[model samples]
Target: MERTLSVLAAYIQPSPYGAEGVSLNHGLHFTGGEPFLNVDLLLKGIELARKFGIPSLFVETNAFWCRDDDDTRSTMRQLKDAGLQGMLVSVNPFILETVPFERTFRAIQIGSEIFDQKLMVYQTDYFMQFSRLGITDRLPLQEYVSRVGLEEATSRIELLPIGRTAYTLGEWYQHYPATTFFRGTCRAELQRNYHNHWDNYGNILPGFCAGIALGNVLEQPRIYEEGLDLEVYPILRILLDTGVRGLCAYAQKRFGYQEREAGYISQCHLCLDIRTHIVRQAQEFRELRPVEFYTQLGRDVPADQD
Candidate 1:
């Protein structure tokens, strides 16, 4: 916490969005394998952020622990007391298989009572859920929305074509032509530079899916003074200038990266595949940090696994 504060104090500048009621100059978020898995620690972090005068504290949870209404309400009350301002509940097909929708519904009911409009539901590409689950288009959208009590006005988050999603779910989506695939710019990278994501180990990433590491929080002064130079990070610079295909070609020439004959589903799919290949073959690329972010295929584990 001290290291992060020092880094923010030294390097971060207030942007236009930092106006009084607009957004926090520094915000803290707790996300993970499941934040509510360690509710005690989650509460402590929120309390610490409040102590530091950090304006916004949010948590993203699968709501797997929201098994019973009374238990769920009790847990949320504790978090709200500890300065938790918002809760992002994961309500989608992946979590639905193990956690009943009713559990999430109960959570939303309790959360709305506490956080009001601050409570929100996040789902990854609702249309893709149909493809994965074999649900037909004739299925009314309200049928799914009614289950969660979320209206159409709720936000929709796109599933990035990275990690396991790239390998498994990417195949299900129709691919764009090669020329068009590389044309998209990374809006996440360009938009928010003030806020960064700090992992459990203090590794700071520019964005969640962006594999490039600015540096670890423990080395605060040096990294802050030097700042994050996109030019120093070869892959990020190439991605900004040439997009995904340029990165594919760079990886092929420098690291002997191989591409699938079927091509990529999106720019992120190609970028992730290149990073996965680089990180696996060479230790130097470990500077990208949080190796698991680039390597772990999400959720679809083999049945033979323990």
Candidate 2:
């Protein structure tokens, strides 16, 4: 890990989007609505990786305002000083009202104090979700007063690029593994699958998934026996043994991270809170997690501000 961070840091600050976000290591992605909002927290994560020598850090963000902010500028400077590398910028316009061009242009114009700007990946799902595809399209949001809605729309735009590590990668991306285990469509089936896993739900559980977990009870009807559990440790060993690493709580003594069940942001609740949770994880983290055990991540993240 130290070797990876050392070499990568020599080049420039990490950009966890585009080529940067797509990891050959753990391929894990941390996503968020406004990851850069917590600049101090993020820098800490970068510093830790640099200290421990984790290769290629990816942070996803929907808000470009951070890179555009002075504090973030200093944060980047600090990361450079601290010797961290690998950043992925998610260029999804809907979430980040600004575009990558604006940031790049500013960085170039702003001079040397600025960090490097590299485009790794672009996403399209946010637009699809906002368009007629998501609950917002068919629900109350669509019914919002047009004049007011138009005002809101006119102000928010997805024009900036940001880190893929904006949100916690592991917990957010576990849908794949969870779904692979729970194949059926019914709530009971999903419940049964999750039930077999030895973990119970938490109060401050990620809001995005909780709503879905609760919703699944009504939407799908299924359950796994109470005696079983997901092979988190065994499965993790395979992933680690195979060289996978990302930003989440698979193994950590100092930081509190748990591999909980996943629920779609559409179905679960605490969206913004989840972002906060990961920020805290990156903040109060006391233990060190190997970078090779991370898995599951993508260009998908909110492009606009949180």
Candidate 3:
């Protein structure tokens, strides 16, 4: 798999339109359902990355397999030895339901000992009230870290209003008025950061919340050299330029799209609604790529078009 990736990387790097002078040396992150689940593959992938002269390799996991301290220690030792530069353990109320906090705490302890400063915790502020487990106050990240004696390893982030959350957990937070659209910018795209996400199928996305695909790494590189073409992607360009309001206007004018009476929770909610409408109305919107992402937002495309 490494050889295949190298060949693909090589193919794009030298091409006139590919990203030249950029190699795996930038960085690579292994994330998904749970990276630690496939320890062998994870280790081999890291080893291959090192062999290819990649500078850094990181892994993100829910720490579900940290039931045994000795086993966790052994796994962390092996990963560290295989050039795993860092590890991120997800700790929150959602994960705490199935996997006890004790197990996650043990993983953090062992990971910190092995990976040293390279170990960190990734957390979100959206914690549901799991009455069965008596988890009411959300996972107190700082308190938990203090208890574990690793207060410096915790990083909290805001929950993005995308995917299932846009429909399910969206009501938990207050949304901006529809008139406030276009007041914000997409920091991820503007920053053009090196950290990119790749799913199991190798689809490279700009960010976790932004479902816009830059093309699959396993295949030819589309935005490798020149970067994403906002103009080519009409939806994204409008969103970037005019924000969700612009897209809403475009949808209304182009496809006669309608807005909900309740308004939107955020720009993401409005964007998803427009995309969902376009997807259901015409097949041409497939140019957006990763059509399944917009279609799976829990809202169905209407059968009839006006």
Candidate 4:
């Protein structure tokens, strides 16, 4: 992965992300095999990011998985003490359906107390309510990506894993998958078109994976298009272009070595309260580029120990 990251860094010109010379206005998020699962590494990465002066560190994690993550929890607390901001928790009603609510909520409670608006809960989708998306009849990939930002539209994204990864609550192991992320591939971030996106690790892809939308993040050179858009709508376009400036690829791998299909690659579902025609464009949105963050208790959070 490190080699791949280095390769990616060398691929783009002027550089798209990181503390490098090109750009630094935007921030980066780190999430994976349960961040707390590797507290030391997580903390190390946080520390390095802090050194880079990253404004925020968004850590999306399953709080239930952290119930026993005392060391990592303590490390996270220390990062908070060191001024690292934002900790987004993936909490849904179905959480208790598999793990003990009390256990997961406990870590969340601690995390909530430590983080501020930085703390958020995923109460929709496979996390809780909501069902499958309309595959038979749906918007074009680009158009759909533009729509996932609405508060009302949140419930409509019935995401299953990308290629073959099934998204059923019954499967406790898989959280979010890479295939799910491939949905956003054609955005010029991954491939130019579904055809070009073929091949993975070393294998040649056959065709579009089920519910899979292939291609890179942006298809062709997007500079001219971005420049023109920026001139017309400065505020929104600035964010759209700048928010993801220094970032590498944003992928969510739910399966193990097999690379299963995941859900919610961009975390656009994280924040969509604001309004805009391109509200869920994700390329540049608060949920995707939160400038400020605070995490507090949910409505009926339990009191801490005496």
Clashes of each: 0, 70, 0, 39
The prediction achieving the highest TM-score against the true structure is 1
lDDT of 2: 0.34
Model 3 lDDT per residue over 156-222, tens place: 4445666556666555556665566667655455346545565555566666544565556656444
List model 2 lDDT by residue over 35-148, tens digit each: 566767667656756565444555555435444657556655665566444344443323333443345333333323343442233443433323332222122322432423
Q: Which stretches of candidate 3 lie above 4 Å from their native place?
A: 1-26, 124-157, 184-191, 228-232, 281-287, 299-306
User: Best lDDT goes to which candidate?
Assistant: 1
The pairs that clash in candidate 3 are none
Instruction: Please provide TM-scores, in order, for all candidate models, with all chains considered together.
Output: 0.74, 0.33, 0.72, 0.38
Candidate 1 per-residue lDDT, tens place, 1-306, comes to 555554444343333434111123345567787998887788777776666666556788877788787888888888888778878777665665566656666777798898886676676355344345554223343455565444331345555655576555554466754456666555456336666677766777766565666667775457756665675567666766777778778888998876665666776666666676777667465346777665554243221111
Note the Cα lDDT for every prediction shown: 0.63, 0.34, 0.61, 0.37
Candidate 1's C-alpha lDDT? 0.63
* Candidate 3, residue 293: how far the Cα is off, in Å: 3.1
Ten-residue stretch with the least lDDT total in model 4: 268-277
Better by TM-score, candidate 2 or 1 = 1
lDDT of 4 by residue, 159-219 (tens): 3323112222213233443233333222342223222211112121112321122211232
Which run of 10 residues does model 3 get worst, by summed lDDT? 12-21
Model 1 residue 175 distance off true place after TM-score fit, in angstroms:
2.7
Give lDDT for model 4. Answer: 0.37
Model 2 residue-pair collision total: 70
Off by over 4 Å in 2: 1-30, 66-74, 96-119, 124-306
